[model samples]
Target: MPSAIRFSGVSRHYGNVKAVDGVDMDIAEGEFFAMLGPSGSGKTTSLRLIAGFEQPTAGDIHIFGHVAQGLPPYKRNVNTVFQDYALFPHLNVRDNVAYGLMVAGQAKAERYRSAERALDMVALGGYGDRKPSALSGGQRQRVALARALVNEPKALLLDEPLGALDLKLREQMQEELKSLQRSLGITFIFVTHDQGEALSMADRVAVFNEGRIVQTGTPEDIYYRPEVPFVADFVGSSNVLPPEIMRDIRGVDAYGALRPEAVRRCDAGHDAWVRNVSFLGASTRVSMQVHGVAMTMLLPRGAEIPAVGSTIQVCWQQDDLHVMSR
Candidate 1:
């Protein structure tokens, strides 16, 4: 499939600081692609460049085969749903959604029709006349989305769209957004700092660091076979162990990573004493000291919780170990 958005050797700078450094990415048509990273990782900057909010200091951006370097946000075939929602206070939900169409010189009837359809697509039907201040956070976000979708852009860029919402609302919106994307069949370029959000929603995720993309893959690939130590540690909980190579194993590096779920409590194995136990609702997490290194393991709920300072065995299959270079 042709790329919906492409960044080729892209770099952006603020004086000497490299806000986005040499990013090369292709977001496939109709795919839910997420840029996941911490603050200052250039994820948002990359999204802005695609949205034509910022020009690249070097290289090029292409949206649907057109060079997007000089195009303004409105000229490009895209819309952005920002973290703040950015609704017009004076405008009701319908007017806010119809604003884009109206600006494009759409007829009043056509604009309202498009806005109403967009609102219904977001499950906010019959909410057109309500003011932004009168709606809840989630409703306001839906209004912003309806506004963006009412234009029927080729792609949608979301810059931390759910960052302002509470945890429960965030999760709810995540599912809603994913479902909306599938139903609309439009390419979505989502930016977020939350790993869980990306893992749960994106079809594939690009992990960013220090203004560069460190890794890009499916959530399973990012979690189970992270090529770099940063990807392993950043995407999920992992216990990085010191380099210990066994001669019999092929393609095995000296350094190893074990996910908490991969490590199991056994009656016999390498000796370890439990240092702490955290009883999560679904599972019990136990931290242990083995060979002077701390390791964590997850036991299923209802399993005998190990007491702190009690000797236990920690065992894992060689296949379960992820070997990566630092």
Candidate 2:
């Protein structure tokens, strides 16, 4: 399939700082693509560039087959839903969702009908007359989504659209957004710092840091086979074993990564003791010290919780290990 959005050697710099440096990526048409990273990691800047909110300092950005660098946001054939909603306080939900069409000289009756349909698509039916202040954070976000959807853009650029909601609401919205994307069959470029959101919702994710895309892959590939130390540490909180230990375990001089779930509490292997135990609803997170290195293990809820300070043996299969370069 053709790309919905492509960045060819794109960079956005401000004086000595590079907000987005040399990012080259393709977001396939109708795919749920995520740009994930921590603060100042350039994920948001990349999203802005796609939405035409920010221009590249170098190289080019393409929407579909057209160059979008010089085109203004309204002409880019894409719409953006921001974290803050950006709704007009004076306008009701219907008017807010129809604003884009109205600005484009769409007839009042037609825009209202389209806006209502969009609101229904977002499960905000009958909410047209409600003011932004009357709605909850999640509702406001849905209205924002409805507004973006009403535009019927080829792709949607979402910049932390769920960042403002509570944990439960955020999780709920995640599923809703995924469903919405599937139903619409339009490309979605979602920008978020939340690892859970990216892993759970995106068909493919681009991990960014220091203005560069460090890795891009499916959620499982990125989590299970990180190419770099940063990706291993960031994606799944995987334990990065020391080179000496890795050499001993795998007989190779390289950085090693082991997922918490891959760790097993064995009767004999390496002398270790449980240091901490965290009760996570479905699983227990056990922190242990093995050969002086801290390792985490996620045990099923029904499994015995290792007593803190009690010595135990921890082992993992060689196949479960991911050896990466420095």
Candidate 3:
């Protein structure tokens, strides 16, 4: 398969700061690829490089096998959907969607037709006459999406596009965005700090840290079988055990990682004292001190909730522990 975007040892330096340092990546055509990381981790900078908003200080970039180093954003077959929506308040939804075509000297009638189809694709067919202020946040987001789709971009770049929505609406839009990406069969490069969104929506994920990509793999691989302790700790706040804990628990000399949910309460297991308990409607999160180290585990809704300050025995599958070569 052709790569929708490729970065070969790309580095973007700002004299004293290295925003993107030697990033090598390949986003497959039609794949839902997620760049997951915290702020200052270089994920957003990577997206800007792909969007032609920034150029690499060193190395080459390719879009669908074409050299993209000297190309402008308008020359690339890609579009960016930013978190702000960036919609024009004065223009109607239809005209907003067709603005790109209008700038490219498209005919009024033809551009309107394309805008209508784009709006229909986002399930906003009848909202052509509505102003930006009249629509809800989610609706405005859809309008922004429709605007991007109007250009028929081969690869779409999303920079935390759902960051402004409420929890329920964000979750709903996550599903809708996934569905839209699948239907369009175009490359979708999503940049976000939300682990849940990346894990759920992406076919593959690249975890960024300190201006570098630490790991890239399927969600399960990134979650269950993390390469380093940082990936495990950042992705889901997994129990990142040091070398001492690893030797005490598993007779290993290296660092280790264990997911909270994998820790099971057992009567004849290692003794630990409950530090705190948090109810999350569907499950209970328990904080514990085991071997003088903090650990956390999620209990199902129907499971027994251990009171804080109580001693509990816990166990986990041997295979569930991921050993890291520190």
Candidate 4:
């Protein structure tokens, strides 16, 4: 399938700082692709480049097979939902959503119809007349989304769209946005610092660091078989042991990463002494000293929580170990 958005060797700079460096990506048509990273990792910069808000200092950008490099923001078939929603406070929900169409010189009836359909699509039906100040944060966000979707853009560019919402509302909107993308079948390029959000929503995620993409894969691929130590440690919590490769079987470094869950608590047989036990609601996180190195293990709920300073055997199968060079 032809990609809806593509970036080839894209880079952007602010004076001496390379905000986005050598990013190459292909966002498939109708795919929910997320760029995940920490602050200053260039995810937002990449999104801005795609939206034509910023021009790449090197390389090129293409949207639906057309070179999008020199095109202005409005000329590109993309709409952005920013962190603040960027709604017009003076306009009602309907008017805010209809503004884009109206600016494009669409007829009043056609603009209203498009706005109404978009509002309905976002479950904000009949909210056209409500002012932004009268709406909740989630509702305002919906209005922003409706405004973006009403244009029927080729792709939606989201830069931390849910960052302002509280945790519960953020999760709720995450689900709503994912469902909306699937229903609409439009490409989505989302930028976020939240690993959980990207893991939950993205069809495939590109992990960025210091202006470059470190890894790109499905959530499971990134979580279970991270190609680099940064990808493994950043994506989820894991016991990153600095063990020498004692063996290599089937291309896996046999003596490397051991997920906390993979190490089971056995009778005092293995060489480990428990140092601490943290209650994590559904499971207990056990920190232990193994061969003079600190390690952790996760025991399932209802399992006996080991006492601090107790001797316990921590055993893991070879397959559970993910070996990556430091």
Best by lDDT: 3
Candidate 1 lDDT trough over 10 residues, lowest sum = 244-253
Write model 2 residue lDDT over 152-188, tens digit each, in one string. Answer: 9999999999998999999999999999899889999
Q: Model 2 compared with the native: what TM-score?
A: 0.96
Write model 3 residue lDDT over 1-326, tens digit each, in one string.
88889999999999979999999999999999999999999999999999999999999999999999889998998998988999999999999999999999999999999999999998999899999999999999999999998898999999999999999999999999999999899999999999999999999999999999999999998998888888999996899888888888789888788999999899898889999999999999999998888999999889999999999999999998989755
- Cα lDDT for residue 130, candidate 4: 89
Query: Candidate 2: global Cα-lDDT?
Result: 0.92
Task: Residues 162-200, candidate 4: write the lDDT tens digits.
Answer: 998999999999999999999889999999999999999
What TM-score does each of the candidates earn?
Answer: 0.94, 0.96, 0.96, 0.93
Worst 10 residues of 2 by lDDT: 264-273
> lDDT of each prediction vs. the true structure?
0.88, 0.92, 0.93, 0.87
Choose 1 or 4, whichever is better by lDDT.
Answer: 1
**Model 4 RMSD, rounded to 1 decimal:** 2.3
* Candidate 2: regions farther than 4 A off: none
Any residue pairs clashing in model 2, and if so which?
A: none
- What's the CA RMSD of model 1 in angstroms? 2.1
RMSD after CA superposition, every candidate: 2.1, 1.4, 1.4, 2.3
Better of 3 and 4 by TM-score: 3
